[model samples]
Target: MNYKLIVVMLFLVMGALVEGKRLANLGHKLKQEAEKVGKEAGHILEGKVAQKAADVVFNAVLRKG
Candidate 1:
């Protein structure tokens, strides 16, 4: 009976370890994807800001002329 209990405990520990590893891997993948998306969003925002700045400058120049 003691040996059976030990075997059961071992299996449970191994299963838990495997599950933990899987969750860690999934978290890593999600983080990478979020970073990629963040970079793309940053680039898009930068472009928009630049365009708006240019428009403001162009309008200012036209008004002066």
Candidate 2:
């Protein structure tokens, strides 16, 4: 009976370890995806800002002439 209990405990511990590792991997994947999305958004925003600045400069030059 004692041996059986020990075996059961060991299995439970092993299972918990496997589950923890799986969760860690999932968290890492989610973090990487979030970073990728952030970078893409930043690039799009930068382009829009640059275009707006160019337009403003162009209009100013035209008005002066």
Q: On a 0 to 100 scale, what is the lDDT of residue 52 in model 2? A: 100
Model 1, TM vs. native:
0.93
Task: Provide the overall lDDT of each model, using Cα atoms, as 2-decimal numbers.
Answer: 0.99, 0.99
10-49 per-residue lDDT for model 2 (tens digits): 9999999999999999999999999999999999999999
| Span of 10 residues, lowest total lDDT, candidate 1 | 1-10
> How does each model score on TM-score?
0.93, 0.88
Q: Residues 10-49, candidate 1, lDDT per residue (tens digit)?
A: 9999999999999999999999999999999999999999
Worst 10 residues of 2 by lDDT: 1-10
Best-performing candidate as measured by TM-score: 1
Model 2, CA-based lDDT: 0.99
